[model samples]
Target: MIGTALRGIFTLPDLRKRVLITFALLAVSRIGFWITVPGVNYDVIEEIAGRQAGTWIDFIGIVTGGRLTNASIFSLGVMPYISASIIFTMLVKLVPSLERLQKEGPQGYRKIQQYERYATVLICIIQSSFIVAWMTSVTAGNERLVPNATFSFRLMAIVSMTAGTVFLMWLGEQITEFGIGNGISLLIMNGIVARMPGKFSMFISNIARAVRQGVNPAKEVTELAIFVLLFVGIVAFVVLITQGQRRIPVQQQKQTRGRRVYGGMRYYLPLRVNQGGVMPIIFAQAILMLPIAIISSIPGLQSIRFWFNYGTFWYIFAYVLLILFFEYFWTALVFNPIEMANQLQEHGNFIPGIRPGRRTAEMLEYILNRVALAGGTFVAFIAIVPQIVSSLMGYDIFLATILGGTGILIVVGVALEFVQRVEAQLLAREYEGFMRKPMRGR
Candidate 1:
């Protein structure tokens, strides 16, 4: 099936073009990941990163694909843009004016996008400033990451990082316009996947070291096998949840027009179980990082740090609560039961055993809440898998992240999205799709 899909993809001129464009743009972005901001020493930053494993520094590296580790021009990556989008998305719901603007159709959407761009720039400036100051302050045995931290250097870093992010934003937009899959997501997934080879190598090297020391490498090897099995199970579980949906049967009223039946059909409205996707996890992680960072930075607050530490009981509890909260929060923001009900009513469609107005809306909200709770619980569980693996398996947090958890979830989600996109292109052109039998129609 994969081989057939590969052939089918390149067989079409337009699909081939989109595929090539996506790869080309992704290659350019990958190159930018290595281009450091001027005057920052990559070697020193890497050294500091090594010593600071399991901190927010490592988290940033994992998310941005090593760009932050080098203080690269693209260090900010697409996160600032993502952050801007998330902020504006919430605003559009909470702010009446923004909500009105959102209802104005494509023109309003474009305006909101413009505002998000402006916000992205402002966020980049604020974030980059802190990053610059932090990097210059980081010292390794009398050697600073930024040797000469001058105003000029700060200015250059700020401009360089912001420009890099803006360019990446533009590149992602282009990919959305002309390429296959979501550009920004593809970029992020690529970043995560790019680091995998090195991590797997490190895991392998650790096993070899254990064998040499006669530390009973058998246990570690057993762990590796278990890891693979767990990974496959988790992936399958993710795909199932990601694609899971509740199909609400809707009936259209039969209509008579000049002795001809104009309507009367039954179809299902598929409401996804995990409509919020990875947003909940992303939001929870961002919010969780703050308290730990703030508390750890304060003098004499070291005793309280463990309370907010990643794997601690209180920390995990709060993290799970946040995930559940944000799952409903984001779902409420994006999905409107009222709107769905209105559309169904206007079209003379009604859910079986439910009225076409407020009742339908109420039912939808009820079902959505239940579905979202399940999804939220699943995501919260996945989020803590890394912590569990790190503690129980005795693997480095970085290594554990790749083996299972948010990293694998994002990788799987994005990969599935990408393949589905390519498959869609193939199906549109009457070609067989990846991991699917040939359809009867184009």
Candidate 2:
């Protein structure tokens, strides 16, 4: 495998250079993740973060690849930028002017990206203000998160965070231009992967402690092993599903003019089973986290805290429902069967046995809906199973998270995308792609 990968990499000079550039950029980004923003006490932030485990803070930190917990300048990570992009995406779909811009091809898309950049800065300012305010309020028996919450401090925090987000966004764009997979996704995945070594160490430590105390650690070790096995299994399953597609056969009609036949051929349009990818889960998590975050932030809601705590039945129930809802919603936003059908019809292509227009659209929609149902169910299951396991096994939610679900999904998805890009490069250079059969020498 290593030989094949090396052969593939060396086959294309441009691809190899791009991959190297991506890693270099990623290393710089990771370094930025450790550089704390000015005016914040790192020790206090770390203590607060440790205390606030399992809350929305953990979720944010995980996404930022632990930068938020570190109170780094890049604490906000690319989330603000992502949030801005999502907002504009919705706006483009709703507002006629923006929608027209979207229809205008590459130039217009660049314009929209510029708009997103502006929006990202604005969002960073707003989010940073709230973060500073929240930190000011956090007091553990008179030890406040922000020791001296002055106007200058607030200004500094906001400016630093906004600048950090902008830099991170720029880094991501650079990675896309000069690296392998999408930069933003790679950044998030890197953060999540960074936590794995610590989790594995903890698992080993727990087994050691149990054994030293003269307790039979077999059950715990067995459970951890099973969890690991399940984690790998789910990752494999996700890769399969993420890559799975329905290949709709397309037979082109013959167009004969005088002496020559121009267009008689067959091909396929591969529609992925999970066309929406992890966007649905990301959207759902953001939406679901909102209410819990709000409720947790309000002091008056302390009486009903049990109802909103993470890993609780109510929380898991609501989380799963939101995941399902967003799966359908995102699918609707991105997948347009009618437009596809029309394009196919205009080109004189039709699925075998299916009519050219609306009927073909309906058939495609039907298949998509069925495939989406399976995919959605699997995603929801993956999202909720870790919580269930954590609760049952008496392990930390963090440990359970590392074992299966969202973190694993992001890891697998990003890795697969990276591999696919590499394979494409290799194939373009007339080298065998990763999964192709090796040629035998005569």
Candidate 3:
């Protein structure tokens, strides 16, 4: 496998360059994770964060690739950009003007993208300001997170963080254009994955400590084995679901004109089982975290914090329900059977055993609805189970995240997408490229 990958990497000059560029850019991003924001004490922030582990802060830190906890310049990460894009996306669906612009083809698409960029900057300013304010207010047993709480210091911090986020967004775009994969997704995945080595080390150290304390090493080893097995299984499951699709058969009518005949063929339109991909989970996480962020900020909500506390039964229950809801909601937005059927009918195609119009549309919707229900449930279970297990085991939240169902799904989904792109490039160049058979007779 390693040799094959290396050969593939070196096969094309452009691919090799793209892969190199992606790694270099990611390295720069990781460096930014350690560069702290001015005026903040790392120890105090760490202490506060540790005490508040498993809260919204922890989730944000994971998403930012550990930047938020470090109080770095890139603390905001690509979240502001994601939030901005989502806002614009929702607006485009709801507002007629934006919808029209969206349908206007390339020029219109560029205009919307420009609007998204503007909105991203605006969101960056707002989110950065709030982050700065929140950081300034953090205290660890009377030690201020930011020692010098001055207007100039706050302004600098905000500007630095916002600029860092904007730069990261630019880096992601560059990676998409000139690198190997989906840049933004890779950035977020990098953040989630960057902590893996430390997590493994922690687990090893914990086992050593347990053995030193006369605990049964056998039990611990067994638990570790189970954890590894579960992680692999979940990754495999996610990969399967991410790649799974339902192919609807379509038969085209034959056309004959004089000496020419056309359009007699059968093909299938593939509708993925998990059409919404990770968006449903992302949306659900953001929504669930919002309340935690708000309550963390407002002291008056302290009394009710117990109910909303991370790892609590209520929290997990709510999280699962929300994920399920968003899965269906997002699926609806992205898939419309009626429109699909109309287009197919207009092209003189029909699904076998189903009427060409409304009936086919209904059948498609029925199949989609059933598949979506099962997929949504599976995703929700995958997301919640790891959190529940980690909380019970008292292990590192970071480890839980990687071992957690959602993280594995994202990693598998993104990795598969990257591989598919590589395969497509290879296939395109093949014969003339790789996977070609020799001609039998010239």
Residue-level lDDT of model 3, residues 231-258, one tens digit each, is 7877877777778888888899889999
Best by lDDT: 1
**TM-score of structure candidate 2:** 0.91
TM-score of model 1 (CA atoms): 0.94
* Arranged by lDDT, best first: 1, 2, 3
The number of clashing residue pairs in model 3 is 2
Which candidate comes out best when scored by TM-score? Answer: 1
lDDT of 1 by residue, 1-442 (tens): 8898899878888989999999999999999888888898766876876777667766765665545776889988888888899899889988999999999999999999999999999999998998898888888887889989999999999999999999999998999899988888888888888877876687577689998887978876777787778778888988888888899899999999888997789999998887777788777878888776787789998767778777889988988999999989988989999999999999899998998899999999999999899989888888888889888878677777775556677788888899899988888777788877888574
Pitting candidate 2 against candidate 3, the one with the higher TM-score is 2
Model 3, stretches more than 4 Å misplaced?
64-66, 210-216, 292-304, 391-398, 431-442
Give the count of colliding residue pairs in each prediction.
0, 1, 2
Cα displacement (angstroms), candidate 1, residue 335, comes to: 1.3
Better by TM-score, candidate 3 or 1: 1
What are the lDDT figures for the candidates, one per model? 0.85, 0.80, 0.78
Error of 1 at 372 (Å): 1.0
lDDT string for model 2 (281-310, tens) is: 777787766766677678887644578566
